[model samples]
Target: MLRQNLQQKLLQKLSPQQIQFIKLLQVPTVALDTRIKEELEENPALEDPSLMTADEPVSEYDDLNERDDYDSEAKEDTSTDEFNVEDYLQDDNTNDYSTSYNNGDDDEEKKETPIAIESTFFESLQEQLDLVPLSDTDFIVGKQIIGSLDDDGYLRRPITSMIDDLAFSQNVIVEEEDVHEMLKVIQSFDPPGIAASDLQECLTLQLKRKDVNNPIIKKAISIVEHHLDEFTRKHYDKLEKSVGLNSEELKEVVAEILRLNPKPGDSNQVTTKQLQIIPDFHISNNDGILILTLNSKNAPELRVSRSYMDMFDHYDKAAQKDKKLKEAVQFVKQKLDSAKWFIDAIKQRQQTLLKTMNAIMHYQYEYFLTADERKMRPMILKDIADKIGMDISTVSRVANSKYVQTEFGTFLLKSFFSEAIQTENGEEVSNKEVKKILEDCIGNEDKRRPLADEKLTEILKERGYNIARRTVAKYREQMNIPVARLRKEL
Candidate 1:
C-alpha cells in the first residue's frame, strides 16, 4: 500500500487572450494585414470598419461582467467533468478588451499594387532544354538531371542514386551511363558551372569555357584540378613553388580563378529571400530630435459585425422560447468574445511596440541622433525590458520580428542590441563599434599581408579596447571574415 500526498504550488499559465496578444505583438507590419484578414475570415463576428455599411447598426455591449449574471455561478463549480455550454457563454472575464477603438482610417480609397512574376530556376532550365534535340528517354533523363541540380548549380546526388530514383519513380530502367550522358548534356547548358559535382569541378568547368589556349586560363584550370586544397587554404607559397610562377604571375592566376562563377545557378535564379524591407517603426531626426512612429499599416480599424450583433439579438429572443437555441447563443458569444480579444490584442500590440521601441530609442539616443556605430552603447534585451518594465521575453518577441527605418538605413531591431564590451578606461561600448573598426582595419590593410588576429588584437589594445586575440578572432568569424591566411593574396 502507498500513501498519497497532496502537493500545492503556485503555477502561472498564459490565458488565451494573453497568448493572442503575444502572437500579435510579434507580427511585423508587413504581414499584419494578412493576419487580420485571416481572423476576419475565421470569425464572422470580426470585420474591418471599411467593410461595414451605413444602414447596419454597430454592435455595442456593456461590461460583460455586469450583463452576464449566470456566468459568476457557473465559474464557482469546479467539480463538474461534464461539458458546459455556459463556459463559452461566460463573461469574457477580461476588462481590458476595449469594445471601441476603431479609428475609421481604413475607409480611404484603396489602390491596387502591382506584383512581379518571373520564371524560377527550374523553369529556366526547362525552357533551355526545349532547344535540345533528344529522344524521349534521353530527354526524360535530361529533365531528371536538370531537376536534380541544386539552387547553387551543383549536382549533389550521386549517379547511382539517381539511376535508382528514375527506375523507381518514372519506370525508366536506365543504367548509370545513361544518367551520366544526360548529365553531361546538362553541364553544357547556359551556365558553364551547372551540374558540377563540387567547387573544383565548377571552377574548372568555368575556366575551360574561357580561352583554353590562354596561359593564365591553363594555369587556373591546373590549379583547380590538381591543388584545390592548397588554393582554398591560401597556401600561396606552395602554389607559387609548384606552379613555377613569381608573385606577379601567381597573382594574375589567382585573379583569373576568382573571376569564375562558384555558384552559377544563383546568378539567374529568381528568389524573394531578400524581400523589400517594410519597417515597423520609423525614426526621424527632426532637427537632431529623434521622433519614432509605428507604421499605420499594422493598425487597422476593426469592429464587431453589426449584422452578427443583430443575429445574436435574434438568438437571444429565440433562446427564451427554445432550449436548443442556447447552443447558438454560446457559439455567438464565443465568436464575439474572440473578436473582442483580437481587437484588444491589436491595440496592445501597437502600445507595446511603441513603448518598447521608445525605451530603446531613448536608451541609445546618442547613436540615433548621429547614426554612428561608435556612438552606440552596449544594450541587451534585459536593459530594454527593465527600462520598459516588461519581461525580457516580451522584448525579445518585438526585437526578433520588427524592423526600424532610420535616416541612415533600415535595420532589424535585433541588430541594435549587443553585449557590452568594456574598454581600458572603465568605459563600455557596443561590440558593433569594435566590429566596425575591425572591418575598417581589414579594409585598409594590404591584401598581400593581411593582418592576423593577434595583430588585430594588439591594434584594438592600442586603441584602448583591451580585446583579447581570441575575442578578436570570434568577432572576425562573426563578421564572416576568414583568417589572415584565407584573406591573404599573392
Candidate 2:
C-alpha cells in the first residue's frame, strides 16, 4: 500500500556546479591541461580562446543582440527562446572566465616539458632473449617467461599457471623443465639476477658472477648461501661465527654482498619514472615580503563557442519549428548550459585555489620568507578552511595533490600542514620540526651503536620538548629511518 504523510525535513545537496568545482579543484596543474582538452572534445559549445582564428571576432553575441533588436516584429513570437538565450550568456566576459577573457599582461605562453624515452625492463630482457639462439618452441617459452616478469623483474607466477596461460592464450604447450631451463638462460643475461624468483636466489646469482677466484667472493657466496638469515638480521657476531670468518674477513664479505642489485628490473625504469611536477602556485620573497601567485597555466582561457551562439540564434528565428528543430534546440540548450557551468566552475576553482594558497602563505609567512622549516607553525585543514570561509573538505580538495614552487624548492601543499605539538613552555610547534630534529639526530649518529627511540626521547626531554618514546619511534619510522638494530653498522 502507498502511504503519504506530512513531514518537515532538511536535505543538503551539492549542485552540479559545486560538484564540478570540487573535481577540478583537486586536479594538479600537471593533469589539468589534459582535463580541459577532454572537456573541449566532449562539449561542442566550449572552445579554447587561444585556438580562435586570427580573423574571427571573439564575441558574436553582441551582434546577435543587435540583430534581435532589429527584428522587433518577430521578437514577440520568439520571446521565450530569445530571453533564455540572452540570459544564458548575460554573465559573458563581464563576470565568469576573466582569467581567459581578461587579466591582461599576466597571460603567458604554456610550454610542455619533453621526456626522454628508454627501453623497458621486459623489452631489454627480450633483446637478450633474441640473441640466444633457440627452437621456436623454446623461444615461445622464453617470451612467455619474460612477459610474466613484474616491473621489479621478479617472476612470481608459478610455472603451472604460466603453462595454463600459454595453453589458453598462445595455444603453445611446454613442459615445466622447458620453462625452468628458459628461466635459467634469462637469469644469466646481462644485469645479473634478472629472473630469479626470490631475493636469496637473486643475490646468489649476482654474487656468483663476481670474482669467483677471490677468497672474499667465495666467503660472501657462502654467507649468502648458508648464513643469509644472520646477514639480513645484521647479527655480525653470529655471522662471523657461522661463516668462520674473523671481523675483517666478515666485513669484507659483507661489503661484497652489499653491492648486489636487489631490484635489477628497476634499472630500466629510469625512462618510465620521469614524472613532471607542475607547481600550482609560486611563492617569492621580495624585500622581506612574501608574494604568492598562482601558476598562469591553472588559468586557461576557455570560452563559449561563438559559432554555437550563432547556431542558436538561427534555430530560434527559424520559421519551420518541427520535431527535429525542437530536438536540436533542446540539445543546444543542454550543451550551452554545460559550457556555462564548466566555465563558471573554472572561475570558482581559480578563486578558491588563490584564496586557499593565500591563506596558507600568510599563516606561514615566516616560513616562506625564510626557508627554514623551524619557522613553520602547526596548521591543519580546519585552520585554512575557517580563514577562507569554506568547508574543511573544500580546503582539503584544494590542498590535495597540489604543489608550490619557492626559492628553496618545490613542495607538496600537504607538506605545510601538521598537527600541533606543544613545547614544555606551552608554545605550539609543527611536527615537521620534530621530524626535522629526528632526521638531523639520526643523520649525525654513531652507526656502530645507533641511538634507540628511548635515547631520542630523553634527548628531546632534555631540550624541553616532552614526547613519548613511541612518538619518537613514530617520527623515525615516518622519515624511513630504521630502528636501533637495523641502523647499526659493522
Candidate 3:
C-alpha cells in the first residue's frame, strides 16, 4: 500500500563548497604549500612571481574604460614613453607570473617553504628489502609478498591466492614451495614478525627469533599453537589443565605474551621521520590562569603581486585593443581572484582551528592543567559547536585526526570530549573522568579477583560516582579495555 502523509522537519545539509571549506579548515600550513603548487599547475592564467614584479612601469587596466578610443599611430607613439615592464623585473625572481600580469610586491614574499624528507613506513621497508640478497625470481616474489602486507606487516593474503596470483599475473609457474621459501626469507627481514599468516604464527616467529631464555615463552608458544582457542576464549582454567601449567606458570606466560609486539612492523618506525603533532593553539599556565596562543604557524603571511596589478592597467592603454591582450587581462583577473581565495582559505583554517581548540581547552581546563583524565568533563561535538558558534560537523572535522601536545603529554583532540554520566551524588560527570577512574581502579586492583563492571560501579559510587553497570561496561569498551573476566590474573 502506498500512502502519502504531510511531514515537516528542519533539514541541515552542507553544500559542496561548505564541505570543501570545512576540509580546508583542518589542513595546516605545510600542506597548503602543496595545494598552492597544484593550483599553479592547473591554472595557467595565474602569473608566476618573477614576471609580475618587474620595476618598469607598464600600461595597466586602470585606463581600461578611459582609453577605449585612440588612433593606432598616436597609441604607438604614446607607448614609447610608456613604462617598460623589464625595469621592474629582477633577474633573481623566478615567479611564474609574466610581467604585465604581475601583482605588486606582496606575492613575492609569500613563497612556499621547502618540504623536508619524511620517509614513510613502506619506503623504509623497501630500503630493507634492497639489502637482502636473493635471485631475480625470489626477489620479485618477495617484493610482491611484501607489498601484500598490511600496516602491521602481516601477510593478509592466503598462500594459495598468492601462489595463484604469481602464476597467472606474472606468467611464471612457481611451486607453492618456492613461494613459501621466499616468504620465509622475507619474514626474516627487519621488523621480524612481518609476513606471518596469522597472529599466533607472527608471535611465535618473533619469539623463536628472540635471544631471551624463558620457559614461559616456550609454554605460551605451545599453548598458542595447540590450544589457541583456549587462550583467545579466555578459558584460562582449561588452558591450565590441558597444558599442565599451574596458576603462577599461566600468569607468567600471559605476561610474556603481553610483552610481545603485536605489530612488529612498528619496531622499525623512525622516530625522526615520525609526524609530530603541533597544536594550532597552545594553552599555557599564565600567572595562575590558562593563556592560549594561536599557533602562528597556521597564519601564513600573503599579499597580491603588484606587477600583475600593473599589467591590468597597461592593457588598457593599447591604441587598438588586441583580442589576445583582452583575453590576457581576463586571465590575470581570474588568477588574482583564485589567489585571493586561497589566501582567504588559509586565514579561515587558522581561525577555525583556533576557535575549536580554544573552546575545547576552556571546556576541559581541569583535564588540561592537572593531567588527570578523571578531571575531564563530558563534552559532545554539539557542546563544542555551540560554544564555538559553528556546526557540529565543523567541530568534528577539527577534532578528527587532530592531536594536541600539552605540558603533560600529547593526546587526541577528541579524547578530551566525552559524554556525561551521573554520579552517586546525582552530579553529572564526564564519561572520560569515569573511564580514567575505572582504569586506575583496575590498575591497582589485585589480579586474583578483578572487579567486574557491577563491582566497579559500586566502587565508583563509593567514590561519589553514581554510574550504572551498563555505563561502566560502555566506558570500558570505549576505552578499548577487555572485560573484568578476561582481565583476570592467576
The best candidate in terms of TM-score: 2
Over 244-359, each residue of candidate 1 has an lDDT whose tens digit, in order, gives 98989889999998888899998888776556567888898999789887776766767665556555644654425455687887787788778878878887888899899999
Instruction: For model 2, name the residue pairs that clash.
Output: none
**lDDT per residue, candidate 3, 1-490, as tens digits?**
9999999999999775456576677665446556656765665434334344578443334433344554666456545744433333223233322232223354543554455566656777777778888788887787788878887778889888877887898876778899899888878776767788789898888778865466777888888789887787778999999989998899888777778778876666544544645555556776658876654445434434555645644565555678888798667666655655555565567667768888899898887778877788888999989887888878887787566767777667877777887866678888777777889988998877888888998998899977678888988897898887788766
* Model 3 stretches astray by more than 4 angstroms: 1-23, 28-30, 40-196, 201-221, 253-276, 317-322, 381-393, 401-403, 424-426
The 10 consecutive residues of candidate 2 with the worst lDDT sum are 95-104
**How are the candidates ranked when ordered by lDDT, highest leading?**
2, 1, 3
Model 2 CA RMSD to the hidden true structure, in angstroms: 3.3
RMSD for each of the candidates: 6.0, 3.3, 8.9
As for TM-score, the candidate ahead, 1 or 2, is 2
Compute each candidate's TM-score over C-alphas.
0.85, 0.89, 0.68
| Model 1 C-alpha lDDT versus the unseen true structure | 0.81
What lDDT would each prediction earn against the true structure? 0.81, 0.84, 0.70
Question: Candidate 2, residues 1-490: lDDT per residue as tens digits?
Answer: 9999999999999888888888999899888989999999999898887776899876655655455444666656666543466655453565334354232254243445667777767878889888988999899999998888888888899999999999999899888998898888988997788888889988989988888989999998888888888888899999877778898888788888898989998877656455889888888888998878777777777877766877776787787889999899888878888888888888888888889999999999999988888889999999999998999999888787899999999999899999999999999999988888888888899998899999999988887789999899888888888899988887
lDDT of 1 at 200: 88
Better of 1 and 3 by TM-score: 1
> Candidate 3 — what's its lDDT?
0.70
Measured on C-alpha atoms, candidate 2 has an lDDT of: 0.84
